[model samples]
Target chain A: MLLSRMVPTGFNDLRREMDRLFQDWMPGDGNFFRPSVFPAVNVWESGDTLYAEAEIPGVTMEDIEVSVVGDELSIKGTRKPMPEGDYTFHRQERGTGEFCRFVTLPMPVNAEKVEAVLKDGVLSITLPKAEEAKPKKINVRTS
Target chain B: MTTATAVEKREGKVRPEPTRGGRIYSPNVDILENREELLLLADVPGARPEDINIQYENGELTIHARVDSRTEVGEAQFLACEYGVGDFHRSFQLGESIDNSKIHAKVKDGVLTVHLPKTEAVKPRKIAVKTA
Candidate 1:
């Protein structure tokens, strides 16, 4: 399988260099900093509840930790590397290390009713909105 | 300018189909070569075992998977959406040394593994020394 990408030349190379320059300054944990965005995540709202899903393949359920305080949701986990031995790698695109993603909900959510499930290497969390946070529709009367 | 045009042409010509018009994503993969076979491991999160599709034809290998919906539309409120839910699609061209018939695949915890065994003709053989 072909893994390495072709080296860009000319103008494309200039853009590539610019990208590298910006990526190096992004927020990171210093010693373990990587140029990737890490495990991808998505957050949306449904009815009175807010849902968040994150792709965290190769991580076991025990390795993950989820916490919610008011509107802030935090997910922490580590993806362990495969066993080491006598093997030559043809392609290595998957990342393995510790990762933490913190997301602040748009609205206040009840922390007591939050539920999280890890299935098929994806973590899904459901946070119900507090009683006062739900939208209230007012009826209009014309005289 | 030239490279940009070439990229656009490639994308236009080779587009992978996504279910329900969902975006196309590429899952991370690791390919390792052993003594007898090559093992491929792909991280296809949110995809069930039944949703994964693997195909091999004309020395090319392709993998596709459908991601489940995270939230219902319109009913929910807008929030942070850094990542998207889409069907994963990736393809790789293989050489003639690989034995396609013996290839096997398995999925667990959203990770798919494909084993490609080397053909007997290409495997290393130990020659016996002759004593005169």
Candidate 2:
């Protein structure tokens, strides 16, 4: 529920990512319904910006693929395995695999002029308002 | 509290910290979820894909990171260091219909993303009843 409210505004997205990455070890076990470590995202509408961001850590801009089909958003990428040799085990955990996720927006987005930027492992895409979605400016003269 | 590793052959004394060497560990992970899927972005800097491990048990997801500090990319002198440099661990609990087998993961930059694909069977399905 809280994930939906994450507004991916520059650094704020960084903070949210830090919290998500560190909170796991900070608490005991039992919260499975937690947010996505990468597959999840937050979308919001404020003023004239319709922002959406996907959490994709450890990956570089070259490894990910993002595109919009109509109102559906798709993200695909692969995670490479670590190269460390054999070692005495204490605790081993981390997920690695091919990932393909899609999200269909309730409302149509501006696909022609969409903007995508990757920063701090998070991908933020700004869907500009289509000419139809933009608020119409009317000239009013004392008549 | 005292912990033992191996039993003593002489006086039945418990083993000390037998496991003293370092190993790869799962880094801390946090996941935020929206209506579509869970957002699993983990902080695992200085860790390559081969150095990390992830697993799912019961309904929880776990991640560990192993540090390889032996190789020093000697560039800058150490002045102020705040980033974590040891083995780390993290996990999360998932739903029954989370399709555990289909769970996917990735790491870009330093964040690890695990995509938990929700089972289509569990998702709300539209059914229409017709009476003739």
State which candidate has the highest lDDT: 1
User: How high is the DockQ of candidate 2?
Assistant: 0.07
Candidate 1, CAPRI quality class derived from DockQ: acceptable
Best candidate according to TM-score: 1
Error in Å for residue B97 of model 1: 1.6
lDDT of 2 at A118: 73
Candidate 2, position A104, lDDT? 68
Tell me the lDDT of candidate 2.
0.53
Q: What is the C-alpha lDDT of each candidate?
A: 0.70, 0.53
lDDT of 2 by residue, A16-130 (tens): 4565577678664323333444456556555454666665555677788989888787888875544333322221234566777776664577898788887655567777656
Clashes of 1: 1
Residue A77, model 2: lDDT of 82
Error of 1 at B81 (Å): 1.0
RMSD of each: 7.4, 19.5
Candidate 2 vs. true structure, TM-score: 0.42
